[model samples]
Target: MKTQNFKTITLLLVVFLTSTSMNLMAQDEQERPRRQGPDAKALADKRLKIPDLTDAQSEQIKKIRVKAQQQTLPIKNTMREKRARLTTLSTTEKANMNEINKVVEEIGDLQTQLMKHRETSRQEIRALLNDEQRVFFDSHMQRRHRGKHQKHRRG
Candidate 1:
C-alpha cells in the first residue's frame, strides 16, 4: 500500500511539472518579438477606417504598393551589396578610403533614386484620393512618422 501511494504521488508530480514547463514555454514564445512581411492589402484595409476608401481606391493602392515593391527591389539589393562591400573594405588590414568613399557615394545615389521613386508613387496614390481622403491620409502618415520616431527613441 505504501509503495502504491508513493508511485501515484510521483506520477501526479511528473504530470504537474510537465504541464508547468509547457505553459512557461508558451508564455515565452508569446513574449518574443516576431518579424512580419509587408502585407499591402492589410495595410490598405487599415487605412479604410480613416478615409473610408472605396473598393476601386483600395485596389489601386494595392497595385501601387506592388509596383513600388517590384521597382525598388533591385535598387535595394544593389545598395545592400555596396554596404557589405564597404564593411569588408573597412575591416581589411589595408583599408582603401578612396574605394570606400566611392561605394558610399553610390549607395547615396541609389538611396536618392529610391526616395524619388517612393515620392512619385505617393503622388500617384494621392491623385486617386478625394479631398477628404487626402486630409485623413496626410494625418495618418504624420501619425505613423511620429510613432516610428517614438519607437526609435525608446529603443
Candidate 2:
C-alpha cells in the first residue's frame, strides 16, 4: 500500500511539473510581441531609398497596404483565436483530438490565405514601381524574406 501511494504521488508530481512548465512557457509566448509583418509606416514610407519614388506611387502604395491590412486583419484575429483554442485543447486532461485536429486544419488554411494575400499585396506594390525601383523593391523584399528564415535556420 505504501509503494502504491508513492507511485501515485510521483505520477502526480510529474504531471504537476509538466503542466507548470507548460503554463510558464505559454505566458512567455504571450508576453512576446509577434511580428506579423511590416507595419503601416514601413508600407507607406516615402524615404525608403527606392530609387526616387514619386508622390503618386507613394500614395498608391499606402492605399494598397491599408486595403490589404483591412482584408487580413479579421483572418489574423481568427487564426489567433484558433491558436488559443488549440493551446487550451492540447493542455486539457482529456484532449479531444478531433477538435484539436479541426482547429489545426483551420489555422493552416488561414495561414495559406494570409500568405497568398501578402504576395498579392507585394505584387500590387511592385506594379507601381519603375524598373529601377522594382529592382530595388525585389531585392529588399528578398532580403526581408530571407531574414525571417535565416533566424529560424540559426536557431
Identify the candidate with maximal lDDT. Answer: 2
Write down the worst ten-residue block by lDDT for model 2: 40-49
TM-score of each: 0.70, 0.68
Per-residue error for 51 in candidate 2, Å, reads 1.4
lDDT of 1 by residue, 48-147 (tens): 5555788888889889989999999999999999999999999999999999999999999999999999988888888999999899877877788899
lDDT of candidate 2 at residue 123, scale 0 to 100: 97
Superposed by TM-score, candidate 1 places the C-alpha of residue 80 at a distance from the truth, in angstroms, of 0.9
lDDT of all predictions, in order shown? 0.87, 0.90
CA lDDT, candidate 2, residue 29: 98
CA lDDT for candidate 2 = 0.90
- Residue-pair clashes per candidate, as listed? 0, 0
lDDT of 2 by residue, 1-155 (tens): 99999999999999999999999999999986554576645544633668788888888887998899999999999999999999999999999999999999999999999999999999999989889999999998888889999999998
* lDDT score of residue 154 within candidate 2: 98
Q: Which stretches of candidate 1 lie over 4 Å from their true place?
A: 1-44, 47-49
